[model samples]
Target: MQCSQDIAAPSEVGAYLLEHLPQATLITLDTTGHCPHLSAPLETLAAMETFLAKE
Candidate 1:
């Protein structure tokens, strides 16, 4: 998971991971900052739940 406007890691990092890792799941929260879980708790949790449900 990552914040769309994260400066520390950036959304490109997530995209790269998703492209490289076959099983990688990229969840981009439409928010700012590095910590998506803290900055976008509900969105993060929802994404997590949706991802976990697929598994």
Candidate 2:
């Protein structure tokens, strides 16, 4: 998962991973910072739950 406004890693990194890694999932939280789990816990957890449910 990645934050939309994350500068440390950036959304492009997630995009690249998603493109290169098989079955990879990219969740972009609509917030700032690099740590989505800390900066946007609920959204992060929700995204994780949703993804895990699919798996």
Best by TM-score: 2
User: In model 2, which residue pairs have backbone atoms overlapping below 3 Å?
Assistant: none
lDDT of 1 at 36: 76
Can you write out model 2's per-residue Cα lDDT over 1-55, one digit (the tens) per residue? 8899999997779999999999888888899998888899999999999999997
| Candidate 1 residue-wise lDDT, 3-26, digit = tens | 889999977788899999998878
Worst 10 residues of 2 by lDDT: 23-32
TM-score for each model: 0.87, 0.91
Best by lDDT: 2
Question: How does model 2 score by TM-score?
Answer: 0.91
Q: Under the 3 Å rule for N, CA and C atoms, how many clashes does model 1 have?
A: 0
